[model samples]
Target: MPTIPSLSGLRGRNTRQPAVGRIPVPMSAYVVDCAVYVDGKRLPRRFTHADAIAEVRERGEGFVWIGLFEPDDEQIQGIAETFGLHELAVEDAVCAHQRPKLERYDETLFMVLKTVRYIEHESPTTANEIVETGEIMAFLGRDFVVTVRHGQHSGLHGLRGELEADPERLCSGPAAVLHAIADRIVDSYLAVTDAIEEDIDEIESMVFAPNSPIGAEHIYLMKREVLELRRSVTPLANPLRRLAEGYSPLVPDQVRSYFRDVDDHLTTVSERVGSFDELLTTLVDATLAKITLQQSTDMRKITSWAAIVAVPTMVVGVYGMNFDFMPELHWRFGYPLVMAMILVACLILYRTFRRNRWL
Candidate 1:
């Protein structure tokens, strides 16, 4: 397993501290948790970001992990200064709308990952949104890993606990932490894709069913949601591949193998998202064809009824003209004959339409 470099004798020379006498922003406001780990076990005492790194440097044998949630510029500035984070990276992290990517700044590797969740509702056909997204940014250094999360559902508290339970994996240092985070995120992508598959299946069944109430708008809405999901999952592929191919020294050879696994899972997700977009497009076309067929059927029925009504109207109109020379005006039998003829004509037309399946 990969491990971060030894922190011995580098305390004052390498570690950057926040400026002295600056008004302190309360760390607890945005900081989720901070701890020092030696040989994969977290220290029992809690520490602030500054204290955590300081403790690691003093001991010369451990690394610090700090997690923060949606910190504003002012709130995160101190941690950035202490960790020597690149200004551009810190700005991107604070802004919270970065594309998934990886960049190296001197010795620190900055990475952004988009997190997604499948929203549940009564039906996909009526739901306003199906996928919700968030962002997670990580700054990986020699002896510390800092995570900045930008959404409510993007919390890493559970992941932190899971890592703490497995000391051997956690012992691999900051790179290991980075790998675990990427693995967890890709797993989420798989789960969301599976759930969306179920929804697509439901929609497919409804679209083909006879007299289905499902509309094209519903399919369009789903397409929009799928597009949103695609945006989150697809762009991360190259970044993950880069990490797996040894793009940065911060990621060790052993950890790069783990990243390769993540990259494979991400590729699966990308394919699934692409397939979904295509299938939704088919559904839209199928729905339109069904609508056109229905309209044609309706028009045929209307034309058949109109033809039947025209017979009686023509017969009545002729008799009511009231010309003395008219054949039907003079004889009682003529009126009955004309009425019978109209009835027979209407029946003939009705049966003809029925035989052709127009009514």
Candidate 2:
């Protein structure tokens, strides 16, 4: 088991007055894991937050990786004090309603990444479940990396383990952690993009099916989800680019190249997202057009039937008047003749309508 830094005992030059507008944060037994690694290998002893800082300063080596899962304000405040985090960014992390963005404060870089999980469902429209979202905020200091994750499936425990296994890569310092995390997130963007594309294809097939009853509702539902995905993945491109271009001293020359690859991957994802938006809009229009055409066909059928029935109605209405001199009222064969005429008129009108496709 890894040790979490003892935040309460932290003192001296690193401490500062607590910022105002602080929420009464609950104490969470929520410390996920904390570890100190020097030269890409974990040390054998447990250390508190204060200890980790002291070790990094005294030894002049290694990096601290702290993971937290939805920590309350107090826990976050402790971590912030330990690392000297930006107040606004800390606020965003605590509240968990932030857009994907990056901000740098002096020697540290604060990044907010949105995480998403595709919800598998049979119907896109009525399913009420498609894309589930979460948030992960990373505060990258020269010798430390702290991550706060909110929502389910947002944990990076597996990622930390994987990075540890690849010491050669993790040797790049905290920037390596940043790259791995970005790679993981953008990889998810690709996964989500692919899943959404499949769903869109299904919707298109249903819309074009000869007698399918699919509606615009399904198309719009998918479009909405895609839009949300776009919002989550698009804004972070510039931040990634900056990292790859070596905007900070913390990101080493060796690690900078990896960010470029991540940026390229991001480019692809964002392009597909744009394409998905256009495709959905086209689908929506097509669906509405199909509905309108069907409605028109229905009205034509109804009108034609009414027209054919009017012939008999006219005859009946005329006969309904009790006029003594009406034609066909006196002859015994008159009744049969009038009935035949009515039948003949209806038959002719039906044929005409069928030929013209009105029926």
Candidate 3:
């Protein structure tokens, strides 16, 4: 990492120390990379913020693209000021919890994107643990592009390399950068939905399993996760459509076409997520129904056994009443006869209960 001598004073005031054996890294280290590109080719060496701005101002042929990762306000304020970014958008960029959106502030186009990477889990009940999120805010100006990223998944290192690899594609100017970022974010949505489908399929199987079953608890949780995924991607549709179809000078015609392709992909992912949500609802309802039916079956079996026990209990109680005139107490053989009658009655009740499918 390149040390900015200008930040040395701030470094001295750092009273908060990190963990044992670990040195506190300067916030300026968040500057992932800064480069000036002309006619689609990257410049030979690195340039500081001032130098990069000066080069673009002096030479109208190229634009400067700078990438940062989770930078603090004090660190990004200077860069934001240099690029003439709007205060509201800059605040959002620093704070980093904005929904996916696109807004125009004067000549600059500000866009917020939510990026997701799927987390692996063993089962559906844990679906909320399956998606991780991050934010990428891109500010597009005539002579420069600045991207501020927050969270673990929003880094653009690979995208930057790929964009550099094909200078022809990148020559589309600041709009190209916006298109690439949108494309990358929407692509991630598709990948996450694909992974989630496997878990959904497993849930469906468990719901329909023969004797073994999974409860609605997990299915309800899975619905919440799908709902979260929906929230992240659904709001961007209108913004993207305006970019693709509406009149915006910052986004050029050719770039709009690329954005249209992205819109189509986002639509697909959105529909799939909706389907997952609906499927989860249905599965939960079915599981509840199954549980109710099982309970009813158990109650019937219990009631039948109680009724059979009552008959024998009544017969024994009557014989034990020490009345001298009792019908079965007069003869010695009468006692065995009464016991045989009790056995016969219990057998008949058991057979009747079994025939009714209550046992």
Candidate 4:
């Protein structure tokens, strides 16, 4: 097995802290594999931007994968200029927070893919919910691959590791690299889907149980999450579909089938997202129904109490009228009798309510 740098140990000097004032990072590269099996001593040297173009021109046949993470805008422009990348594609890659998708620009193919990591944070509650956001952009050419992105993208890291581990895969060219990237990206979505579904299951249980612990705000936030997920992944389907159907010279004949497999994976993700959206809608409805029912139950109790108290209120009102001919007012047991009558009326109302199943 070919040895590649371990992701867990690849300590970037600048990664621990943000770069100052949007300065462009200088480019870097290292060789994972050098020579082809058939081409004996003919090995392509790994090089950075200006050198990469020169090296490609010299060799004129082998493939290359140049990945950039949180690169400076000027450096990105320089790479594009060196490789003759489309201006629009370069601009899109430089722009942050773009949805995942693939676009063809004449000879080159531009693909924007989401890279997600499940971040765990301390919480008062037992476990923390995942915090997710990352992106990877690839500009695929006939003989070279350029990937640019913001933040620490694990998907890209995995692809690099895979390439390093298996030299044969590196020789598989642009299409294989694209497939590796897509597979990792799809795996990210699967992770998110699993978390979301788990949340859904919790919400479902809460729906049936009276006085659920999960709050209304949490469910609404979850709905918003699913909506955002749909927004990010939906645009990606068409590009993957095109690649799967073998639309370009970049995607190899052997690997087009795998791209189709990736397309199916995204299709499954899309369908699940749709179903989750509906489940979220149902959760909202169920939450509202539970709240309404509880409120109605409370209101009935208050109204019933008020109705039973009305008799005592009426009796006091009549006694306070101070009419000399009133029979109860002149009796010795008048005050006690009035208290007794009020108590009796309360009991009678309580029994009536119990009989009617209104309590």
C-alpha lDDT of all candidate models, in order: 0.93, 0.88, 0.87, 0.73
Better of 1 and 3 by TM-score: 1
lDDT of 2 by residue, 60-101 (tens): 988998888888667788789878998888888889989888
- The sequence of per-residue lDDT tens digits that candidate 1 reaches over residues 335-354 is 78888999999999999999
Please, what are the lDDT tens digits per residue for candidate 3 over residues 1-359? Answer: 98766765677586676878756555459788888988888999879877997997898778889988888777888888889899899999999988998989999989898888888877766545777788999999888899999988788999999999999977888789889999999999998999989999998988888885578888877787788788889998988998999557888788999989999999999999988988888888899999998999999999998888888899988877888998858798998898898889889999998998989
Which candidate gets the maximum lDDT versus the true structure?
1
Off by over 4 Å in 4: 1-25, 28-46, 121-131, 153-155
RMSD to native for every prediction? 13.7, 10.6, 8.0, 11.4
The regions of model 2 sitting more than 4 angstroms off are 1-28, 123-126
For model 4, residues 302-327, the per-residue Cα lDDT tens digits are: 88888898989999898888889997
The all-Cα superposition gives candidate 4 an RMSD in Å to the true structure of 11.4
Candidate 2: pairs in clash: 5-48, 5-49, 6-48, 6-49
Ranking by TM-score: 2, 1, 3, 4
Q: Give per-residue lDDT, candidate 2, residue 352.
A: 96
For TM-score, the strongest prediction is: 2
